[model samples]
Target: METDYAIIGGGVVGLSVAWGLLRRGKSVTVLDGDDGSFRASRGNFGLVWVQSKGMNQPRYAEWSQQSAAIWAEFADELGDATGHPVPLEQKGGYDFHFSEETLQARIEDYETLKAKIGGNYPYEVLGHNALRKEEPHIGPKVVGAILHHQDGHANPLKLLTALAADVRRMGGQVIVGKIVIEVSKPDSFRITCADSTTYGANKVVLSAGLGASKLGPAMGFKAPIRPQRGQVLITEKLPKLINRPSLIARQVDEGGIQIGATNEEVGHDDRVTQPGLSGLAAEAISAYPALARAQLVRSWGALRILSPDGLPIYQESADMPGAYLVTCHSGITLAAAHARLLPDWLEGTGAAPDLEVFSETRFAVS
Candidate 1:
């Protein structure tokens, strides 16, 4: 019997979509990549961030806000089902600025975006002294921060483990080590693997991170996405010195301060560089002086799956109507929306969201 949905890509994006569909009583199967695949899910800063996103697209900001609002409940449900603790701190997070000019400029840009989105962005501009009151370890070079109240961080590995477990708990099948090379829609969708294995489903979701570029064109998508390398660093577990998360650094639930994420335009190279690590360390130490004494634990580089416009793509294939391409950079931030609201869109329910803005038509199809 054909499954209701055969989801390609077992990363957080695909699994979250699978989890949502399974909650709606749909038969689902997830085809996960092997060990050799570039898994962004493993190498993220683990922030459920909202600030500084969607400066151009108000709808993208609104969508991220929707996901952030329900993230706690999503974590609780996942933990209760899988008995795995997914630690999340959602008090708020910061977008730090070292210069007054940049801070004011960002505030103006945010004001424009806030007006477009009906002023739902909850944030406060904290001066350095005010920020020091909240975080005493803040360095003097820091100018200020925009504390967006909807932001937070989580343990990504725990979230992934729990989702994989709960997907199976809900009777969803997960197949690993199968690289999907082709997809064809006959009466039902037939997914062909690189090794000649086949799976059948009434519908297909192409959420395979970087691999979507290879299969999307055949299934009717331009898939103009690229890989951006982000180098991240982690220090040894220490006593709480930082209170909130930033684009610069955040203390993880495991007691280590997570610093990083240098956005480099290196194609498909998720390997760390000395220069990348050094730059991240300088910025982190400048933000928090105490980090200068912290011992380094590990560092890594992960490739971010980004679209041409830095927005997510959620489009159903025009030629193959039942197949969809779902890719995004903020998989951790959008997991709640994908697991709760996206199934309605996929199933054509009246509650489906207005996702017309995210369609690939925005990009010129060659």
Candidate 2:
């Protein structure tokens, strides 16, 4: 079939782009992988976070803030269309600290980044007393917290469901369990899947997460991406014991305290280890104390796709025009930006956000 855009990978990144393009009257078809593929969207920590992001590059921080700003509108639009409320809380999120030294160091770094970003960063340093007042369940071991007003959390699964439903409702074709094997540009673009199914499109996008590592070079992309394993845990649903989300833990909308995310550089291995789970539990208990008595309900691991500098890479192919590469680890956080803003960049419109800093050219080896 012929389409305006043939998107490889039906994950959040690809689907978000498809949703945006379809909203603009673009004909799109999304080809997703099989069930055996590593789906990070299903196993994420569900954080719409902004604190401690883009410390070195203020542009990234600004991009995240941009997305965070529009997430409510984006979610509301999806809810209006699909009737699925994408639960989002932007009341603010925290970077809980166990000692004053670490908290002060982070504040110093944030101050520097804030200046670099023209003082747009909105955050406040909360002492133990202040933090306790905000979160009475906070443990004494937690010395302080940095509450970044832009940071928040969401129901990732609901967001994904809504995006898929609305994309289809908007006349976008979503083909699942189809692994695209090759993409070639002779006149337009021809994409061949492993099962010998072929698709024709005027433009193509490779947002296949970790799968980009293999398919990228053929499409004239460096695709310098790797997998980092993140192990996460969740407790049984109970009364609200947590007020907001921190790096250590957050109370999910369904009443379970979702504690997670041990970032380990295990290179494609997404298996949860006993040591990782124990360490995470210990830290959560130390932060909330009440978590020590909470019943542990579920635990799992997922792989995160990362560029060399831990930033999103947005590059149109140098060799093959009309081909683009979009990949990032913070899919849930940047979903709104991808759906609402990224289409402008992809379409080369006058309103496109200046994304030069995120181009793969930054990774060119000099």
Candidate 3:
């Protein structure tokens, strides 16, 4: 049977869009790569965060807030449908600062961004004393923090499981282990897999993360995306220690202290290094001195998909009218928007979001 839409990637971004389209009564087939493909969705830090986003582009920040606002409803619906619990905490998150100078600098940036976005940014700078009152375990070295009320985190694996289950329950076909080879459209779109399997659809969505760099130009998209390596670490499950999630660390739903993510631009290399792990441990320990005694459990490295200016790229293919390219690094944060609001834009309804700012026109062509 011919599907209504053929999603080229089965990651969170692709699956979220698939779920949205299926809810709109559109048949979808998600073609996922094999085990060799770099799967960023599985290795992310699981933050539904808003801080440090769109510091340069307020529109991006507003979009993040929009997603965070509706995330609870999104999680609830998915949980009700699939019977999978999505552990989420959205009271607030932090930007922990070790020194007053850095804390003051970040506050200035936040204030400037707040004005640009018409003052909707809800955050307050807590001095060391105030922060200590809130987080009794906070290290004395931590000077202060910016508590952004909208920032939160969730269990990303549970989310992925729920979305996949719900999509299938809604009758969306999910084909895995098939590397898509080609996509061509004459009257309808034709997608071919490496095993010579073919699927037909009326439209197509290219959300294959870094794989878009290859498949995008074929569908008339300037999918100029890159991969930035982020090394992460996790400690053994401990009692409730971290009160809120931060860039430095967080206590995940599973009780593990998730520490992370050294941003290294070492092109396409996802292997962890001693130096990278050491640096992360040092910073994490400094942020919470108690972590120095925690036994190390696991360490990993994953590549984050990024655009030129680090904003999302949501553009309909100009050459292939029925084709769309949707990619972003903040897949976990934006999953709610992609699942709930993005379908309107894809279906060309009046309620479609104003996503022109996220289009590819902003990229510099070589």
Q: By TM-score, is 2 or 3 better?
A: 2
The estimated TM-scores of all candidates read 0.99, 0.99, 0.98
Candidate 3 C-alpha lDDT tens digits along 1-366: 789999999999999999999999999999999999999999999999999899988999999999999999999999999999888999899999988899899999999999999999999989999999888888888989999999999999999999999999999998899798889997899999999999999999999999999999988898999999999999999998999999899999989999988998999899999999999999998888899999989999999999989999999988999899999999999999999999999999999999999999988566
**Clashing residue pairs in candidate 2, if any?**
none
Model 3 off-target regions past 4 Å? 364-366
Q: In candidate 3, how many Å is residue 68 off?
A: 0.1
CA lDDT of each prediction against the hidden true structure: 0.95, 0.93, 0.94
Clashing pairs in 1: none
User: Which has the better lDDT: candidate 1, or candidate 3?
Assistant: 1
Which should have the higher lDDT, number 2 or number 3?
3
Stretches off by above 4 angstroms in model 2 are: none
lDDT, candidate 3, at 53: 98
Instruction: Count clashing residue pairs in model 2.
Output: 0
Rank the models by lDDT, top first. 1, 3, 2
Error of 3 at 125 (Å): 0.6
- Tens-digit lDDT track of model 1 for 54-73: 98888999999999999999
lDDT of 2 by residue, 1-366 (tens): 689999998888899999999999999999999999988888889999889889888899999999999999999999999998999998999999999999999999999999999999999999999999999999999999999999899999999899999999999999998988899999999999999989999999999999999999999999999999989999999898988899899999999988988989999899999999999999999999988999999899999999999999999999899999999999999999999999999999999999999998899899
